[model samples]
Each structure stands twice: as structure tokens, then as C-alpha cells.
Target: MTKAKVGIIFGGKSAEHEVSLQSAKNIVDAIDKDKYDVVLLGIDKDGKWHLNDQSSYLLNEENPKLIQLNKTNKGVAIVPGEVTDQLVNLSGSEALGQLDVVFPILHGTLGEDGSIQGMLRLANLPFVGTGVLGSAVSMDKDIAKRLLKEAGISVAKSVTLTKNKRDQINYEEVKTKLGLPMFIKPANQGSSVGVSKVRNEQEFNAGINDAFLYDHKLLIEETVIGREVECAVLGNENPIASLPGEILPQTDFYSYESKYIDEKGADLAIPADLTDELTKKVQEAAVEVFQSLNCEGLARVDFFLKDDGELVVNEVNTLPGFTRISMYPKLWDISGISYPELINKLIELAIERHQRDLQLKNAVYED
Candidate 1:
């Protein structure tokens, strides 16, 4: 079999750009060398794509493969046509080879928000992970929550604040509705980039201001006091959910520092200590939410098992973290899927979906 040319695109124009770089590095270093050839592309903070080849370290370092936006760089994109000469190097200075697949390691905003997927779709590229609709639905916390709720899934009560809606958000009214210790987060950000747990009026005011910096829309979800569990979902049509894993954060909630930078901040509970019945429920809920959101290729579904021990859906991460220590891969690794094999599986799903889509008549004509 011909080795597929895999383009690992990372470092997007999102708050999680640095995290994306670290993720891509781990994947590139760990992916099975014999099976796939790799190309690294970086999207700068300004959203320009470029070839990035620089020093990379795991979750620790901030240097996300150095990048420069120029037409001559080997930044990967779908070749516009299936002509014999498929790959088009906009940078005429050199010729870069065609890519068989794209592994998007982009986090947050432009990367996970369906913008990149839109571009990839326009270029007719087969990229790993969720497509445009799924990505868009999952990225917006408000929409995601509603969809899950409509599907009869338990979700935390949330109030979405959109632009031009400066209607008085009274402290008493909000606290009465969602209660104190509610979670405030950027509607479309991940990696805990703009998330905060507010315990009081002062904290609530400040947290909202902070979250608004990352996205125009803000979501405040009522805090669900329960064990935090995660399950990884994979594949296109009939996706499977991995065994659930519990997270015990060293601090209040899984904050950014607790997740990546802090060594002693969080611990993982694999095959989470749960009754057989509860386990089955969680796994089923994870798969249900995945399908409900139209997610393809992959997703990490989070849930809160309340003090009463009933499971409630928290959120769906279309492109969850890929770092070795990240919950998505860690949960799968413990579930019998290794890093390289997981990567391969994702690519296969992407190709399968793309091929299926190709079979559909996309053009509209009038007689």
C-alpha cells in the first residue's frame, strides 16, 4: 500500500494556538513512521497558514513551531482538482508534494470553529475529525447544549449572552436561575482558555468580562456538583465510545493551569470507579451525544455524575486535546487504543466520510 501523505496542521488563530502546536508536536513525534509520511503546517495568530519547522516541546513549551505567512511556504491545503498534477504550490519558488490526508490539531476558534473545515471543504480535502456542521454545532456551547437537551440528554442550565444583548443581567436573577459557583466560559473556546467558576457577584461580573475577551458570545452554565467523567468517541458512521475516565482536579474545576501547566493539579481515574449500570449509562450517553451533534471522526464527551449519582451531559469537544496527558488520548490509551493506532483510525474515518460525501451529487443544476 502507498504510504499516505498526512498533513498535521496546527497552531491556529485561536486562543489555544500554543496548545495546538504542542499537540501537533506530540502527534508528529509519536505517529507510526512506516505507515504515513508527514507534513507540518502552522496557522499563525493572524490566521495565515504557513510552514512551521521549529523547536517543539510537549505541554510545557510556548514556542509553537515558528511560522511565517508567505505564498511560497509548504502550508498544506486540498489540491483544487483530481488532475494528474494535483498538488498546487502557490509558492512557485518550489514544489511541495500532494497530501493524502489532513490531521487538524487546531484548538479553539478558527481551527475547531468550522472555519478551517470550511476551507478544507472548499478545497475538496479529506481532513480528520468532525466536518463543518458538527464542528460548528459542537463549538458553540449554547447550540450544543440545546441539541443535547432536545435529544433528552441531561444538561446543565445555561444562559447564553450574545453581542448587542446588554439587557440587564441582574445578580439576583442570574444567581436565582443558575446559582452561585456557576461556570462561565467563552462559548466557542476550549483548553479552558476563557473559562471561570464564579462563586459570588464580584467573581461573576469579572468572569463574564474575562470570557467576553475570547468570544463575542458567552455561556454561563449552572455548576453541577458531581464527578467529572470523560469518554472518547471515534469513527464516522457507527462510532464507539471508550471506557469512561474520571478527573480529580487538584483545584476547583479543571482550569487551564490544572490541565496543562500544573504537574500536581489533576489526576486521572481510568475505567472510572462506577457501577456496571452507571458505566453502561455513561457510555450510551456519550455515543448518543456524539450522534446528536453530527460529530464525525472524533469527540470527547464530558459528563457530571451528580452527588445523587445520576449522569448528566456536560459538553462535547469535537477536537479535544491530543497531548499524551490530555484526556482524549489518555482515555483511549487505557481503553486499548494506542496513540499511533488512534491516529490511524481517525484518518481512516476521515477518508471514509470524504469518499462517501464524494459519491453524493454536490452540484445543483437547472434545465
Candidate 2:
């Protein structure tokens, strides 16, 4: 059987660009070479897409640095055609070939926020991760929390502040409402970018200002005192949850620096020391959050397991980091799925979901 061509797209115009590069590098290394032919695509900070060589793509592997798009590499121009001729060189000199499936290893912003997914949908191509609606809703913390709350899921009490209402915010009132040690974050970012822990009014104001720099909407969530646990969910429908993992952050919280840059940022405890009953509860809640948000392909559902055994949904990451040290794959690895196997399963899930979607009547009028 001929190997399927898998396009691994990464390095997006987002705060998590570095994280995305790291993920793509790891994915390229672990993907089954016998089963799939890999194609590397990079989106630069300026949002231009280029087809990069394998050596150029894995430039960051040795030192574990962020890889940037090599401007000299052939530019990729989407031809907007049938499945066989979508991706081609901008000069139109080379067809570059077609992709059987695309694994977008990008995180945050335009990459994970449904823009690329929308483009893939228009191109009639199958790609990994959530669909447009799921990606959009999951990227926005405000919307995700609201939907999760409406679904009878417990979430941290929080308030959403938009740039227009910046001046109207009463810090004292916010303090009274959400209390101290608040978690301030950009509503649409991931990998903990522009996220801060505010203990006093000074930090609260600064955190909000910093968060607004990344996004117009900011979320101020009351601190939930519990173990920071996460569960990985996979599949389009009837998703299965991996054994929970606990994050032991060396920093005050899991900051961006701690997550990607810092060497001693955090430690993971797979199958987190929870009772069998509590473990089941966490897994069940993870699946609920995944389905509630209409997530497909895969997602990492974070939760706060309180001392009293209350499982509070933290957030759902539709395109969770796929770095070697990332929690999503690590949890699944502990649950008997190897790294390569996990990658294969995700790609299969994407294709399976696409085939299922093809069965539905998509056009409004019959031809």
C-alpha cells in the first residue's frame, strides 16, 4: 500500500508560535515514516506559508529552540481546487503534491482558532483537531466557560472584561466579586500566554492591562484551590478520556515561561494520585466537557480536583500542545498509548470524522 501524504502545518502568527514549532518538530520526529509521507509547512510571524524541508523544519530539535519559516524556502500558495491540487508553489513551477491528511500542529490564534480549519474545510481536505465552531468556541475562554456552565458543569466564578469597558472596571468591585488571587488571562490565547495570578489590587490592574495587550477580551477567574489535573480526550464521537495527570508547577502557577521556556517549570504525575472513584469522575467530566464543546479529533480537558473531591472544569484546549513534554500525549502514553501510536490514532480520527461528515447532505439544494 502507498503511504498517505501527511502535511504537518505549524509556526503560526500567535503568541504560542514557539510552542507550535516545538510541537511540529516533535511530531515530525515521532510520525510513522513507513505509514505516511510527511510534508512540512510553516506559517511565519507575518502569516506567510512556506513549504520547508525536513532539515529546515527540524532545525530546533537539537537545542529545542523555536523554528521560524525560512523565507528562501518555496512559498505555498493554495490553488483552491479539488483535493489533488490544493497545495502548490507560489511561482506555479512545482505542484508540491497533494495531502491525504493535514495535522495542524499549530497552537493559539489564527492557527488553532478555526481560521486554518475553515480554510481546510473550504479546500475539502481532512485535518486534525476540532471543527470551526468547536475551535472558535474553545479558543475563547469567555464563550467556553459560559457554554460549560450552561451545560451544568462547574467552572470557576469569573468576569469577562472587554477593551471598551476597560475604563469602567472598578478594581475594588472586581476584588469583592472574584476575591484575591485571581487568574487573569487573555480570552482567546493558549499555552498560558498573557496569563497572570493577581493577589492584590496592583497586580490585578497590571494583569488586566497585560492580558488586554494580547486580546481585547480578558477573563478574571477566581482562584480555585485544588490540584491542577488534566485529562486527554480523543475521538470524534464517543471520545475516551486518558488517565488523569497532575501538574506540579514550580512557579506560582503554570505560566508561559514555566510551560515552554523554563527548565524547572513543572512536573507531571500521571494517573494522578486520585482514588479510583475520583479518577472515574475526572474522566467522565473530561468527556462531558469535550462533547459539550463539540470538540472532535482531540482535546485536553483541565480541571481542578478540590480537596473535598469536587471536580471543577478549568478549560478545554482543542489543539493542546504536542511537544515531547506536553501533558496531553504524556497522559495517553501512561494509559498504554505510545507516542507514535497516539499520532497515528489522531490522524485516523481526523480521517474517520471526515468520512462520517461526507455522509451528511452538505449542500442546501440538490444538484
Q: Give lDDT per model, in order.
A: 0.81, 0.88
- lDDT of candidate 1? 0.81
Clashing pairs in 1: none
Report the Cα lDDT for residue 180, model 2. 86
TM-score of 1: 0.91
Candidate 1's displacement at residue 246, Å, is 0.4
Measured by lDDT, the strongest candidate is 2
Q: Give a tens-digit lDDT track for model 1, residues 1-367.
A: 7898888888767877766766887798788889998876766667656665534322345433332222224543445665333344555634566778889899888888798899778767899999999999999989998988888888999888875674657778889999887888988888788898889989988988898888889988898888999999998889999999999998877887777667578998887998888888888889999999999999999999998877788888999988657889988888899988998889889899989999997669845
Cα displacement (angstroms), candidate 2, residue 280, comes to: 0.5
List runs of model 1 lying over 4 Å from the truth: 53-94, 364-367
Q: Evaluate residue 155 in candidate 1 and report its C-alpha lDDT on the 0 to 100 scale.
A: 90
